[model samples]
Target chain A: MRKKILIVDDVDINRDLLRAILEEDYTVVEADNGKKALEIIYSMKEELAAVLLDLIMPEMDGFQVLEELNRRREIIGRVPVLIISGEASVEVENKCLELGISDFIGKPFNNMVVKKRVRNVVNFFDSKNLLEEKVAEQTAILREANITLKAQAEQLKKRNQEIIDLLGTVVEYRNLESGEHIQRVKGYTKILAECFMREYPEYSLTQDKINIIVSASALHDIGKITIPDSILQKPGKLTKDEYEYMKSHTTKGCELLDAIKSEWDEEYKKVSYEIIRHHHERYDGRGYPDGLSGEAIPIPAQLVSVADVYDALVNERCYKDAYSPDEAFKMITEGQCGVFSPKLMECFRKVRGDFEGLAAR
Target chain B: MNLKECYASIGADYESVFLRMGSDSVICKFLFRYFDRNEYNGLEKAICEKRWKDAFIYAHNMKGFALNMSLTRLAGASSVLCEALRNGQPEDGVSGMLADVKSAYVITEKAVGNLERE
Candidate 1:
């Protein structure tokens, strides 16, 4: 399609001369003065390819028109302006160039020069717009690819968690503990961690922290895999030396996890390491392995400690019958198995009914 | 005399005008006639009223038209009158420039009439 050009001149003969020169290659629009030209520019901004503007006019002159165009940033770059003036001087040309005109054509129009400059500028803007469109298209494609990559990473992460849980159950089966033991511990940790997040803003137990604690709970007893079968599966209470061998499970579990020769998310690895190494640490600095006191224990491990003891007490094992949820809860609260943080005990008290419901199920 | 002789007598470049307008005598005649009907009367009224700005506008417009038509004498005289009015020259100096413009316009008109008769 032929592009549109606006001819702005106060004199009919001048406008006619420019129209005669340009109308062959373009659709010409005429305005008698700057004010009328501005009106046309406003209404036909998108259609116009260039403006052939005369400097001297009544109402608003060429300089005023250029100023208006400069003020409207959206219109200025989009439409190229060619100044046609009788008073063409170096000063006028410089001023128009500073105002961002595309080209200048003096009065007594040259047929060839006007046509060529107008065509050249219009084609230049056309190519510029095409480049911008291509860039926008490429950006959208990159954004789509980034979203797909994130989803695939999430899928790979879920697959990795499944493999880790399968390895954990292998260790549970060797000790004659039900696979449900890990599942119940994960569930109870989530309950306690979520309650703490809601009731105590200072604990900063965000949802991400709760997820890590739950995932890490399944690996808390992973060290038992390295303990001798005789010690792990004995039908009676452990001897002192056997208990010492049993206590090595915490440190050994950390070693086993550290020994895994594969890449993983650093956050998951850190959370799992904390839970496996410190879940047995006592709140009062008396429990085995590290005797970590109060907040010295990582919050993830502390949460898992309460969950592991509660699940162990309420679930059946090869060595003992399952205690009722009420008995398990009393033991944990009364500090029978080990002393827990008072804040964690408070969270446990709020969700003890939910725990009984899960055990019953 | 022919239009060329009359144009030469008035110090106008008839050959260049003919060439620039693509030898279109009808267009040349039309523009000269348009100026006679529209611009000349407005310029006379403006000069009579001593409205220098209005007189300058008329003179500037006539200067551009005369230049395009290759009427060098008329274009040059109008340009002088335009500058004199624009620069706020004394009344006697502006009137003298206006007289030169008027004489040039009369010669240009007679030259156009000669072309029309041909």
Candidate 2:
């Protein structure tokens, strides 16, 4: 598109000549007086690319226009200005130059010289404009890339949250509980598991290991799905056969996970297989499903076993009214010393408030 | 003439021009004129006789010439022939290669040659 060039000259003859010279290559707009020029300059500031100003005018002179242009520094500095005058005094030329006029055209100028100077100035302006356009294009491309990157990051965050939510949902679906019981149990188990691993670094509770523990904790009772709903949702006591059937859920969970071992990578198989198999195994020899004892079952599964039992005891279930937090704490603490490690119990006590809050929710 | 000798006369930069032609029409025309009518047919006969090594070298040089002239599809066909001959699969890619060479000849000899003479 052709750039708009404003002509500000009081003389009709001069404005006509300049317009004739520039109009074919440029879109020309005229203002006969400096006051009118300022009005045009301000009103069409966004559209005008350059200006040609005549120095001597009647009311508001070129000097006054230059003064007004300078006063609006931000608006005038960006627009290119060319000064045209019959006056050849050094003083006047110096003043125009000091006010940052782009170029000067002397009066009685040769038509060829006038055309050449204008063409050269316009060519320079064209090149400068091209460079600015390229920069703006690059900036827009960079902004688009940044926006895409931000959107992808948000998508990844939501995806991670959704996976966590899904894992919690799986546990809820198996037990027929509403809300995220698995999420709370998994979180609490993670805190206690890390503390237990720290107290005994022989187990190698590295950050990656901790993450796997937290992830695998959600599957601790996944075997419960295999138990019949009659036994699973039973309010009261279970017969020996029903109790034995219920106990087999842990082993069944492990076997089910084992069947899909070929499809998953080795790490996932190891963690999930261990969690479903050993979560119910007691620290002492007395626990059901497996006779495995202390420091034997995966620490994560053990931690989750403690947290799950605590949550179950403290929360109101269909069979029994909820126990007080104090009563539940007393049961876990006073019963079997070897059932849960002392260090883990300490961490559990520290975050007891969080568990209580989760239960309330 | 030794093609390498012609290149040496004009410095290393001269070789880049030939390198650019591959088996393209410009070099194809240059070679056609160089050997006259008997030459290209003679090379083709050698390939038919199962003189594998000679056919391989001819196809390799033709491949280079085709690419340099910006006749990309022609170069691609020649490239396949060159690879087949190099890998002792000359019979595998030969029919397709010969078809391409004939089409490129028609385009360059009729279209571009007519345009140039005008």
Cα lDDT listed for each candidate: 0.82, 0.67
Worst 10 residues of 2 chain A by lDDT: A260-269
Clashing pairs for model 1 are none
How would you encode candidate 1's per-residue C-alpha lDDT over A95-176 as one tens digit per residue?
9999999998865545567778889998998888679789989999999999999999898778658756776777777854
TM-score of B chain for each model? 0.81, 0.55
Q: What are the per-residue Cα lDDT tens digits for candidate 2 across A2-114?
A: 87889987655457656756777779999988999999999988777788887766568788999989998865566778887654568778889899887887553444555
Range of the 10 consecutive residues with the lowest summed lDDT in candidate 1 chain A: A106-115
| Candidate 2 wrongly placed segments (more than 4 Å) | A1-4, A11-29, A42-49, A55-58, A61-79, A85-101, A104-114, A130-167, A176-180, A183-220, A223-309, A312-324, A327-351, A357-361, B1-118
Compose the digit string of candidate 2's lDDT tens values, residues B40-110.
35347657888766666555444443333334454566566656766555656586676675565444333
DockQ, each predicted model: 0.23, 0.00
State which docking tier applies to candidate 1: incorrect
CA shift at A306, candidate 2, in angstroms?
6.9
- Model 2, DockQ value? 0.00
